[model samples]
Target: MAAPVPLHPARRAVGEALAPGELNLVGCSGGADSLALAAAASWHHRKESGPHAGTRVGAVVVDHHLHPRSVEISGQAVRQLKGLGLEPVRIVSADVDCDSRQGPEAAARTGRYAAFRKAMSELGAARVLTAHTKDDQAEQVLLGLARGSGTRSLAGIPAARGPYRRPLLELARADTEAICAHHGLTWWEDPANSDPRYLRSRLRTDVMPHLREHLSPTIADSLARTAAIAAEDAAYLESQAKEIFPTLLEDPDASGALRLQLKGLRAQPPAIRRRIVALAAVAAGAPAPSSERLQAVERLASGSRSRGPVQLEGELEVYRGARGTAEYGKLILIPPSSG
Candidate 1:
């Protein structure tokens, strides 16, 4: 017997994630990946047992309003999802806001996820699924490599995060396209996909093809494998850091300043230690801290024992003040004043 089609695993993924008496949502973008996912999730929701026994399948189309064709694309997606028996279909616009320093892609992603989270809360959905195939994972790994980011960035898109899940992460993009073809389904190809102005678009159209043609036809698979390994390593290191993080924090000051012990931080492996500092930085409401900024934090921690307090960009300050026989002092993170 031949192997089952793309929807086979796709349905199984949805079943594992959902149970009876729950609502499952698919984030559709009128693209092949999401369209295939919606179809599979709808099928699974109609199943009798195993999982998704009494679940309802719904679709949420997020319109970033970035282009003139956004509304038309969203309408087409809604009609297709409705035809596939998706329920409670609706479209929402994302309010994309970002400073000049931020790129358009990053701003758009921020807006898109915000919209998804809002929809999830309002709809009371158990989980929101987006179709991110292996192609995306590979692209992410390459992008991370180009940026020289640490292992976490190279780890690629997670299968599940918060209330969002990517059920198609293990599948290839071709599988989704095939699934659409099999069902006689039509999908939208966003013009942005081929627009060289975007890094991702260029990577998808030019770099990846060149790499596959010249270096290896299996480049995507190789990169995806690299991401999987990186993710495993990152997950394990994160768990260790979580276990050790509490040991680094000292008692809060009268003004609610939180301190992380410099000695304890220095004792940890570089990976875990860096993660803890990054976590504290984020907790203090610092914007995405770059490697240089992170290194600055580390320098202050290990620098002159008699030096004055060093201030981080997030209003967090650290100084060499003794706390319980520890003269090197602790690194304290301060939040920006609410007022």
Candidate 2:
């Protein structure tokens, strides 16, 4: 009997994340990382036996139309995905709002993910896989640190969120490029990635290289490791907060305001407490509070000297209940338009 051919590491990685008989859509960008992911996913689903039997792989190429040649690039990606035997290969044009307050990179990302979600719904795919390698993870960590973000931001990009999954987080950018080369694939290089206007692009071109040279040769690996540890810590804290969150709710008022038991909230550690507050605010139709806003909420909940009906984003406000009322020692999240 012939010896079984060894699976390529990229293919193995893709297969490990995917389950049998499930339809998955690869979000290909015609870039090295995404193209390699698409290639590996196709290879995994092509298997007629073993773990991946009956699995189907499709592809979605989102064209943000940010660059002049975006449509052409998307067409090339679709052709490549089709060549790899990916069924239902589709190209989606995203209307990216460059003037968004979130900035260009974030705006483009928002548009891209929206397109991915729509494609998944239309294609009946169980999950949308994107190529976010270890290098990207490291970049995210650096960006978070630069912005002085909290543990959740430092945790970097999640491996899986909702219907989206990133299978290449364990692989390096070089690994993806190598895989693409091995497959004789020519990937498109997005100019935005190297443009100095974007902070991420600047980091990729200048800061990261400087860090790699001056700080540590394996700085990306170290950063990725840090992200993994942070992710574990954040996930545990979030789970704990979620478990305790419902117990703290003290029944909503008639005007659609949400109230939490201050005593119960104050008992938790700072990490869990902040998360719980944020969760409650979101549940009450408020945008996710910023670090500064969270601190303000914390102060209000702590019964600080300043009595506050603390104004939060999305027309929501947080107020501490008066000492004599039935709502005493409660943190009330007043919804929009509630007096």
Candidate 3:
């Protein structure tokens, strides 16, 4: 048998992420990061003997149609993926809603992910690998901070969520660019990535560069490290909250309103207490409350001031049981139409 060929570090990383005999799709966008990922995935699947030996790799290109030449760019990516010997290369067009309340970037992302899901379902792929590099993780953390987000938000892009996997999270953007250059691949530069109208674009083009110059040359790495730590903490806290949550719940009333013993809730530390409140709200069919609203719920539970039912999204309400009643000293979450 011929000796196994050595692989590039990026290619090895991609190979390690794949399971043998699985059908995986690379989410390519003709950008340097995604092109490099596509190249690496192709290299991994071509290996005749290894952990990823029987892996079948394909590519999915989502055209958001935000730019005039979006279709042309997607065609280029498809040709490149085919050139790299990737089979089942698919191009999906995303219908981005400009009027979406989440803004253009998020709207486009929602549409893109929907397209990915459709392609995955049609191709019977096990997972879709994206090219969210370390730099992207750092930017996400900064964005979360700017929005005064909680630990979960600051946790940045997860390495894997559901059927989507990001194997390049540890690789720097520069490393992906180098890989593309080594493969003699020409990648597209998306203008929207640098447009000042977007907050992330401002951070990437201005804030990040300024921080790198004055704060630290490795600020991006530092931010990415913070995100990892935050992810760990968030996961641990959520697990603890889930464990303690069921014990605190009281049987639902005749109207299906949920209740929790205030004593059990107060016994928990603030972090765990707030999480339990959020969980209870969600269980009562309400959307997760904002930080300030969560704090308000806390006040309603333990505060001296008189405050009645706290209104939440999804037509749910939370309040402390009134004194002298069977429901006294309990937190009640009233679902819609339950009175």
Candidate 4:
């Protein structure tokens, strides 16, 4: 990785980082990071190529109709992109019910990503660039820790995925803001971001400051370092799992439910076995079972004579057969009725 650079340099770095055949779909949210990213990408494109066969760069702004001002802000963002000499793709808004106990932010994010992925596929986008700065990564790690999440939680946000990339992951929040300001860009300040109703807001406004004052002044940087370490460890663990997982997982339909080879699972170490089960759940899009659920599944597959089946969350069940043979199963996902 090279040293951090100015806005234009960062844009050039992103352009150079992409593969020769790759096309970019920038996610612009009218915020500092995204605005800066759009500007940087435009500058990079102008610097890298002639009018013919120039690198394809477009912008997508997802309108989550959560507030009255959301539509206006999204339009402004698209206009900003157009002003920057880029084509703006508009994604129609979606309504998500965020009244769950888990809070609205998470739900909104889930829906936003869904829409983003849909738009990417519809537009034949090769890769989607996001505006996650280093501070966001640090904040995510802290929030995950506060939730008592497992090792995966500590890994924070990923830099690259199937179609998602975060080119500004190395940049700080202040630097992103400065870049946008230096270019005379304007953005909307999400009111919900400042509302104390959200945990992340409280953490950003209160906890981080206290930590900076009392504990370590470089807490954000330290948290970012911790997230990096956790990401490395998680990657190693996933690699190990990948090597061992093939033997444990069975083929399934489009629904992704798999039958586990209980005999092979039991032979593996307890820790590895738990990870295998968790990974299976993740692959199935079902939440990972609790420790007790894992232990129950273990007992169901073991030599113990259980008269009944071991039931777990998400309708996952494990039943034992005549001679230590066991079956792990899950209910099929039923599509919504067309009525």
The residue ranges of model 4 lying beyond 4 angstroms of the native Cα positions read 1-5, 16-19, 46-53, 100-102, 249-263, 267-270, 282-313, 320-339
Q: What is the lDDT of residue 64 in candidate 4?
A: 82
RMSD of 2: 3.2
Query: What tens digits encode model 2's per-residue C-alpha lDDT throughout 1-339?
Result: 843322277787788777568889999899999998998898876568898888999999998888899888888888888888999899987879999999999999999999998998888889999999999999999999987779999999999888888989988888888778777788999998999999999999999999999999899999999999999999999999999999999777779899999999999999999999999999999899888899999998987976578988898889898889977888989887787
> Which is the better candidate, 2 or 4, if ranked by lDDT?
2
Clashing pairs in 4: none
Q: Candidate 4 — what's its lDDT?
A: 0.71
Clashes (candidate 2) = 0
Residues 1-339, model 1: lDDT tens digits: 744567788778766665466777899899999999988887865556654567888989999998899999999999999988988888988888746357888898888888888888898887788899999999999999898889889999988887778878888889898888877789999898899999999999999999999999999999999999999999999889888887787766566666787778888878887888877767666765666666666776675554545566766665555547554466767655621
Error of 3 at 54 (Å): 1.9
Report clash pairs, candidate 3: none
State the displacement of the C-alpha of residue 176, model 2, in Å, after optimal TM-score superposition. Answer: 0.8
Q: Candidate 3's C-alpha lDDT?
A: 0.89
- Sorted by TM-score (best first), the order is 2, 3, 1, 4
| Model 4's TM-score against the true structure | 0.81
Candidate 2, residue 144: the lDDT equals 92
Ranking by lDDT: 2, 3, 1, 4
TM-score of each: 0.91, 0.95, 0.91, 0.81
Query: For model 2, what is the C-alpha lDDT against the true structure?
Result: 0.89
- What is the lDDT, from 0 to 100, of the residue 245 in candidate 3? 95
